[model samples]
Target: MSAYRPEFEAALRLFARASEAMKARGFPAPILVGGGAVELYSNSAVTTGDFDIVTPRQEEFEGELKQLGFTKPVGLGHTPLGWVHPELRLGFEIVSATVLNGMADRDRLVLIDLGEDGEVAIISVEDMIADRMGQYASGTAPEMLEQARQLFILHGDADLDYMDRRIRHESGGDYGVADLKA
Candidate 1:
């Protein structure tokens, strides 16, 4: 199976540029999260319609994104500023924190180049799955449960114990260790 998707490529390219620009300005690279992170970690087994980004440095990061041609904000006045790529027609939502399966800290981030000009910061596969599971439990994005299951089936190496803890925590025991195994 080929993990090739034009949307994924374009999003990564934009993210890499934004990351590099932020670093050039002495700001930390934001961690890629939500569906976009799932798409990358799944090798494109799943794709996202929008990019969900997390960083404490919202102002600085938005400035970098603006430099990369993401000028028009698209959301209805939200904290997580939304933008549409003028050329690619892709969308980006930048937030300061991860509401689902939040990382312990930025130290958990890993940088991957994906053969691109600059590397992108991403959460671990375990964290990404837990994030999906959190979404599932919330009843807001039940589709994430399927995304989580697909990612687990595709990767086959995520930390089960860690994933279980996150699922149980986020689901408040409504989902348990058995749920993770399933």
Candidate 2:
């Protein structure tokens, strides 16, 4: 039997527990952002501790995580090598403030299952790519050039042109993919 992907399992456990707790008190599931959602959409990223979820306005969920026993895990240190986004240390970036509220619509977001555990919120793959390109290139990671390569190679058919454009426009270095080569 296949074992569980630890990174996914751990993140899912955190997300699902939070979702359940929030619903017990009544709040919408948080919108999943970052690499795992990207892989879920583009079908590329390896299992990683790089999952990041965001709510349009991160209020209720932040309170819920506190209630659910997640006490804002501070960064222990930088993540060791051979992992996903080699920068930004893994863990929740739960925000308890109202930022970017009333800007983007809630309808465009897609829902992906975190197993029978329940649903997880996410933005569009195109949007994820666009967001990655926007300001947090590689989510401020220097080693994410590898993920760009995989995304372009595996999901090339899904959004080759968009990925190509984004990589060239945003990613600061070579992706090692021939078609994506500048």
Candidate 3:
């Protein structure tokens, strides 16, 4: 698994352009939010084939594509990787308050250097665990639980206590260390 890989250096250029576009236009952070954001680090989710850019005040542009709880403008020039730039599109997803809040306080997230190629500034694993909980909170997917368990088993760092607290808070019960693999 090429854990947490996304289109590299070009995305930074695009981000700068997008950020500048937003700033110059008096928009907010113009943050990146969605699977692309998460895949910047974790191997859990991969190339979602789309980019999710969020802004406070949005004006629809032509060629906007809306799906997966997101809206993107239509006919943005494509990258070599064939992914679209959302800023060029009029489509903007109205993201959750939590996501917007997280983007505001970007320092809370973790940054792992993917290389000179590009660094991975991903949401912290703790937040990743918490955020993903919404999908499986209803006991719908056993595989989802397994993925969480695997994440803890392999990359849990030394903060078992912290992981446990998050698990309890989101999962609604303690699986206990016995349930976790050594």
lDDT of 2 at 94: 45
lDDT string, candidate 1, 28-61, tens digits: 7788888788888778878777788887788788
Q: Which structure is stronger by TM-score: 2 or 3? A: 2
Per-residue alpha-carbon lDDT of model 2 for 1-182, expressed as tens digits? 02445455555556776776666666666776666665555443355555566654466766665564554433565332212212233456643122123323356577656665666666555445544544335566644545444554555454555444544554454331343332
Relative to the true structure, how large is the alpha-carbon lDDT of every model?
A: 0.74, 0.51, 0.44
Please say which candidate is ahead in TM-score: 1 or 3.
Answer: 1
Report each candidate's C-alpha RMSD, comma-separated, in the order given: 2.9, 6.9, 7.7
The residue ranges of model 3 lying beyond 4 angstroms of the native Cα positions read 1-13, 20-34, 43-45, 51-94, 100-107, 111-121, 141-143, 146-150, 174-182
- On TM-score, the leading prediction is 1
| Most accurate candidate by lDDT | 1
Candidate 3 RMSD computed on C-alpha atoms after optimal superposition onto the true structure:
7.7
Candidate 2 is scored at a TM of 0.58
Q: Candidate 1 clashing pairs?
A: none
TM-score against native, each model: 0.86, 0.58, 0.50
For model 3, residues 70-123, the per-residue Cα lDDT tens digits are 232336563332224443432223354345344233555554443433333345
Model 3 residue 4 CA deviation (Å) reads: 6.1
